[model samples]
Target: MNARTNIQFINNELGQPQFVVMPYTQYLELSKSKQIDTEAGVPSEVVNMVFDNNYSPAQAWRKYLNLSQVDVANRIGISKSAYSQYYKIQKLRKSMRIKIAEALQIKPELLDF
Candidate 1:
């Protein structure tokens, strides 16, 4: 049977696609691939921060990348004190977060507070 034949779809009242149901085996396969994609080149510290919540995402990523506060601040064109304050706040503005993410070589979404 074709792949589509093994899947089921649920529609909303307007007949719009709302949910998908696939075979358990197919779901497992897809999950494994996605896990691999997410883990590749991802530092353990970063993963721990994302999953464990013990450390701020920025702190975790900065440590994982072996960067100091001053280093990141300089890269993002901010002063060390300003960087320290922002990092301590753990609630960065979106634009500043994106710039910091770029400095750290990571996606901005990963820095979500």
Candidate 2:
């Protein structure tokens, strides 16, 4: 309306206040809190086995240490192909199971069915 009215409204708006700047301490804290993982090494074989076998993370860890399918056969004192047959039939012998568990440094119960 009038200059005086406009001035009055402008003063009222100014009185409501607004942020002009963030505090320096808060900015510093935000920068410090940000994180990135730069740690380096080969990924664990246990983790890789879990993904490859479609087994649960725990099972994969156990199997990764037990050795390859071929190695498992050798360690348990069976031919690889025979072991494959036994595996297919769900016919793991008790001695073989114990040998596998010992080789893997795991309890037999940890292995998947």
Candidate 3:
């Protein structure tokens, strides 16, 4: 193939790589948004902890709140039957755990994953 043809062929095969790149202004806006979200009463530490895959802050919060499975389920917006499944200790997704921690206003890291 000609050089131009080869370049076109290679480019076609590779396609465009997907990426997420924010300009400085956009980055600042996103940062400000995150700060605002944090300030809206969800503690930063709890948010971080709940998002961290290595921790299960829900367990700790459940203990601290002295809530039974039914109570925790009600507070966290889950069904009591679903919460019962975790009674003997079950894993939670990172987002779910964080949501629970945020709902309880507790540090996510304290859950002891």
Candidate 4:
């Protein structure tokens, strides 16, 4: 492969490169050739759902996926009311978080916020 000459590296506060900038045409080519992990990010709709509606991460994801609480509870093998309590609780257990992620088919890290 030829070395990239048009790419630009952007640094963060510590001066370590935090982003990569390239021509849109080059980006289109690279994206077609590579298998990007789409799961590594969340949609702006989810963020809006949280800030605009006061929804928890789980709640936001649930609404984003158009799933009802009963559906999530059924997926996780818990009662509907039990799942409802999760949103009311301040913090969730790691196991519960994992279970919720599995039910939503999303990475647990997405719910970390």
Residue-level lDDT of model 4, residues 1-113, one tens digit each, is 98859889999999999988989898778667775455787767988988888888889989999999999999999999989989544356888888998999999888877
Each candidate's clash count: 0, 0, 0, 0
For candidate 2, lDDT tens digit of each residue in 1-113? Answer: 63432112222455864422445565456547753221222125654655565554334543555557677677667787866664532324666566665655566544434
lDDT of each: 0.78, 0.51, 0.55, 0.85
Q: Rank the candidates by lDDT, best first.
A: 4, 1, 3, 2
Work out candidate 4's RMSD over C-alphas: 3.6
Candidate number achieving the greatest TM-score relative to the actual structure? 4
Candidate 2: give the clashing pairs: none
Q: In candidate 3, what residue range of length 10 has the lowest lDDT sum?
A: 4-13
Ranking by TM-score: 4, 1, 3, 2
Give lDDT: candidate 3, residue 15: 79
Measured against the true structure, the TM-scores of the candidates, in listed sequence, are 0.57, 0.36, 0.39, 0.72
Best by lDDT: 4
- Stretches of model 3 off by over 4 angstroms after superposition: 1-60
Off by over 4 Å in 4: 1-9, 13-17, 20-36, 88-90
Residue 85 C-alpha lDDT in model 4:
88
1 versus 4: better lDDT goes to:
4
